[model samples]
Target: MSAASAFDDDIRRARALEQANPAEAGRIYMSVLEQDPANIEASNALERLNDPHRYSSWMRINCVIDPRDDIFRFIGTGPYSHNPIREYLSDGWRTLSELMVVMDKLDQPLTRVSSFLEFASGFGRFTRHLVKVLPGRVACSDVMPGSMEFAREQFGVEAFYSSFEPEQIEFPRRYEVVFVLSLLTHLPIEVWGRWLKVLAGAVAPGGVLIFTVHNEEVLRDQLGVKFDETGYSFLPSSESPSLEASQYGTSLATAQVVAEQVRQALGTDPVLWEECAFWVGHDAIAIRPHG
Candidate 1:
């Protein structure tokens, strides 16, 4: 068969199987993996379907028992103190809803999985969001001991502290949904490749890897903002205009480039890439192929 025809055929078959027997979608995905072990899309679909317990555990651990400290009360009274945790966590839920729209278009169910490993999980907000909306288990790790401790005490999440250096950890098991939000925008570009490799290794084959980064165009439009090389803003609200400021977000290409670099570093491809316009740039969702 011609490449175009073969591609069309596979899409039709995959869509049909997904529509007719969504529950058995994993089995069909396994066949796709058999054809190409490194097919990230197939691997992700299978992974999300097969791991129910891990996802459920995450929801119970993070959502049911929040671990954040009362840091929300510490921010000075102003726009900063206006429920930052709720604002941040709700943003993640909004993003997840956008992803669900895509899944709905593809005639796929947004099934929950065993565990979601949220790296750089600041105060476990993303973990909190996932457990609340998705119904899954969560394992959150950060480089800051204070962040982890605060998260544990306040949010009741199973938090761990692992530094960006050496880039290693000893988790009990590989996570099914590994996520990194507003994380790459904090690290130096040179460090991202190593982090990507580590994150790839952290995910079980057939798991989904979600993350965010900046787009240069958006950054260009917001020039004069005091931003780190990764385009992270450190300015307080009084110092800069809200539009130009980072506000813990970046442009689409900034994230896309990092995701590509990470894929190259890991030698794996992402099944899906969603560049939504919530804050700015792209917050992509990638799935590694099953072996």
Candidate 2:
């Protein structure tokens, strides 16, 4: 077989081995890379399998055996099926790729970033990849102390504990890139403004603040809620308590409402606004411009 065809076959085989035997899959990916250094798929697969911060065996068992954790339920749906570890690592790759594109759009070089912070990191799902992509100190924070500990131990990151109340939370230092993923989707409207301000405050001037929100697109597709004149919709945790509603439930914000909130928080409009920039899904991305 030709080089390209052989590479494709190896990738398929690696993917099949990934869930059942990640270490073996990693070796296959490494061999593919040796043959074709520029194989992005093989490189990404190898990285995911070889990540030092990957969840421990017991942690993987918990996610697969119990499936009670909200994080597992969120990413392990459909394609991931019952394999939460694969889902988790896949999300990290997807998130990193998206953020790189966003940074390129902003004309910000990932190499220039000296410090990165991932807010509401949730056991370092994305943090693990962030540490690999950026040549900087990657810090992760979450309201759950256990999650922070896990991130620190697994990823060798600077970990900190956050508070449920946004106003009470503080970072040790400013960051060139601050990412808030899946946090705003859970906050109530009253808490949104405060959290936005606090997270934006953590960004250094001329830096970028990236965040995700469940927008009207998600509301329509997932909840069967049509887009109304109002720019926001709230679904209490008591209502639909699955998927995006795993935690405090879901709040769907429109582009207009999210823009207004960012304006209120930063006193200026975002540099860029894109709907579904995350994984081509319902999440919206807004970037604060560099001064």
Candidate 3:
């Protein structure tokens, strides 16, 4: 077989081995890179592997990860340096790809978006990649300390202080495309609708608000959690160490539950919906506030 097909075969085999034997998967990716140093596919895969995550300037992003940014720390390769910053940087590209599909589904091509917001943008993992595409059009907000500053300084995008209480977060300006990734999946039910309304207000007239959420059925089936009639569940625990457990725990809700919240917040049905479109299991939906 050709070298291209050989790389494909190796990547496929490595992916199959990742869950059961990550070391073997990393070795396979390393072998691919040994043959082809500039292979984007191998580079992205290897970056995510925590088997001593090293940086070889795979993507060559000229940004620094915050020391307190637990999101980056979780997958990073070392204690002193953020070598796996590559994964935090590259996995964000996949997020961009997902947003492309959502934007197309809403008839709002991402390339044409005049302004964008990444709400609750923890450590700018995805925002870094977003700035590469939209540049000056991008703005990021987060409650995490130093998150907004790092985003602004490193990516040259707008940055704002975010609050746990959505009502307290007044934006510098509204956005044509407001994207909230992995945030609703962590909010309690009491504030879910409130936050949704606040985000709806941040969307420019005729613009869309996009976000990701954990599926309620997945909560029940995979996590074995019992949901009430509202079809919501909260674990009061998460990987984030900066936020309060009760305030920013893991959340899951059904489409019906989320739809009602949207109706109450934006007075409109979702313009686009996709199950497991983001992060493989989180549901993604986009709604136009003006409509």
Candidate 4:
């Protein structure tokens, strides 16, 4: 068979394995390889069929697990609140491939900080990556205790309470870098302003505050952009927007406008905004200096 034909065969078989029994697929490939050690295709297929969850990199972040999977209460939803990273990765090959380029643009040393804070750390997918990239003391905080516990168990990092409410949790003397990926988008204007101020205060004078926001203008150009009927800022809604509800849950703005707002609210002197277009979304990286 031609190499192309063999490759096509592998793809078809792999899809079948995915649909039928991924577990069995791994065994089959291993069994075939034992019989004929020269079978490179079978070896490759087996490697490809290996469980994604088995990798430390994939499993170290437990927040990535489905929340509804017996650990958390289920409100009759099928499994969990949908795997965001899984969903993102489904279309994220290009995005994942561009990480090096993104890091290059940031140009910050990975080992510069002794401690770090990840706001809205989600399932800690990005946090795990950051942990590997950044050295020294690492602290992860999430709005959800479930997520914090999961991260603690999986990554072995110190987890802390991230809410504004008073709690026994004690933060370190200061953090060298405070990062919030996709966290600002969930906050309304007023709340975001407050968090930005608090975050600014938390950073050591020369540290970096890295964050992403829904840009107002570029989102207007996306295929399905819509405005809230409540006449608030243009927010894309799964359903119609109401005045009582703010756009936090439903709208995305252009990165440029978000950058501008951060400049006005945080510091006017030297905030750097970079437009990052990836497969999952368009984001701006705002590097704000502390104090």
Candidate 5:
């Protein structure tokens, strides 16, 4: 058959099998792409099938769990509280949506970004969605090797292992956007300034650094403390001495304190400071000045 006729036939078959046998349908759609690299319909179909959000509950459960890695279990079940899978997915969506807003306000549209770095990425939670939205080379890093492996294998992103020490970790190159989600919230006060500087330095000049941190509001509700007076608070993890406790312990900072930390670390005032902007749960946005 002619190329046009063959493409049409493949498209019809792929659509027919999508709901019942998406894997096979995906293969067929991918083959169409191989024949015609610019086939938008086939490309869209393939992307839809591969989207984590569209995955079945069984698939999500499997994706979130790795027998060798306990970080997945901790993040999924710990912060999520109830219905881990659903909440995790929802948080990813909410984070992406809010990031879009931040980008728009900053005049840095997602389309303009050519590379992204997700620091402290845990099992591709947000990295998966970021890849879909950014259309860039997405690289994820975590102190845990298993988490990095899981993100690279499951989310189709480049991955690297990081060190707990801010100065020890390195990247292949700077990125147009560096995302730090739920990471700063757990760092101890001692490393806060240094980590912020290191992460901010990863952004290309004129690029943006977006991060989430527990604000004063959280401290008030959870610990009955006022950040304005104390600046920051840290609740030592009960699981101390374990990596989880050191990396996932409860910490909070006031907006002023966060901005001050950014200024001290990055040598510039934060561009935006929204109390609980991330899923209504973090503060601060900084942009690297362009030369």
Candidate 6:
């Protein structure tokens, strides 16, 4: 190890601000750890950041966010344009809180789940806070290679590759909570249910598969969209940079349409569908097989 220099003073400042301004403190710790991953002071402080009860600001906001994470770009807005890094991290926590509510509705709290699968997880946005909550049990999957790796190395969890073709997407094993947040909201009409069927298969027996969608209300109100005869609509654009927009564009559907897709995907419809359960636009549909 190298001798400490001005970095020690930075750590001191971080310590002094821990209670008064944890967000700034965490940002400082993250900065230190980024420079010296072995710094005990910053490492220990980051460990504390994983506390579920700690303020949302306790987690380091910008430890390793790639500059290419387009979602981060999308989140940068208004005052956040100056420092979207902070809002990016807080926004993840917001998603976690929303999931907790869904779990409660399903009678399956986060504490009870033995394993979790975050499908289409991008760049550890929600994965970061999720690891703090689920820890060792968390697993992530995405077509983007670096994303899963980033989550595994930074957050300490399992990760695997997901393919564009639903039949080709492999899983190491089943999970009690298989969350496909926002992915369905973007899949093109041609292969929506095909992807849904494959994801549903990843859910352990008696477990829930929770996925989000842009429902009719959100489409009509937010995007001024009108669903076609198929009861859904899509546009060939999104925040992604790699995936072809034609296949991974934005999509919206009515609750009835989404429920039918779930039924057709899994041959059953034991789904708990809630409209505008989050983001005041995305609908959450959690499906579990019949007893």
Q: How well does each candidate superpose onto the true structure, as a TM-score?
A: 0.55, 0.70, 0.76, 0.59, 0.71, 0.77
The runs of at least 3 residues in candidate 4 whose Cα sits more than 4 Å from the true structure, single-residue gaps closed, are: 1-53, 57-103, 111-113, 164-170, 224-248, 254-260, 277-279
Model 1 misplaced stretches (Cα beyond 4 Å): 1-89, 95-111, 134-136, 153-155, 222-260, 289-291
| Candidate 5 residue lDDT tens string, 1-291 | 114355999999999999999988988877776775434456557556773333333333223333334443454446434544345455666777877777777777866788889887766667767877664488989876578878766677888888987888878888888988777778787788888878877888777788877767766786577655668777767322346675558677777777777777777776766666776557646556442
Tens digits of per-residue lDDT, candidate 1, 42-136, equal 53354345434222233343322122322222222225434333343345566567655644443443455667677777655455555555543
Pairs with backbone N, CA or C atoms under 3 Å apart (clashes), candidate 2: none
State which candidate, 1 or 3, has the greater lDDT.
3
**What value does the lDDT take at residue 51 in candidate 1?**
33
Candidate 3 residue 281 Cα shift, in angstroms, is 1.0
Q: List candidate 3 segments past 4 Å from native.
A: 1-57, 76-83
What's the lDDT for residue 225 in model 6?
A: 84
Q: Write the residue-wise lDDT of candidate 4 on 124-224 in tens digits.
A: 55555566555336777865547778767656777776765323335555676676666566555545556666676666766767676555445555545
lDDT of 6 by residue, 143-198 (tens): 77587777777778898888888898779999888998899888875687788778
Our tally of clashes for model 4 stands at 7
Per-residue CA lDDT of model 3 for 182-237, tens digit only, reads 88888887787899989989999989888888766677788777767878777899
Worst 10 residues of 1 by lDDT: 236-245
Top of the candidates by TM-score: 6
Clashes of each: 31, 0, 0, 7, 0, 0
For candidate 3, what is the TM-score? 0.76
Residue 70's lDDT within candidate 1 is 23
lDDT of 3 at 16: 96
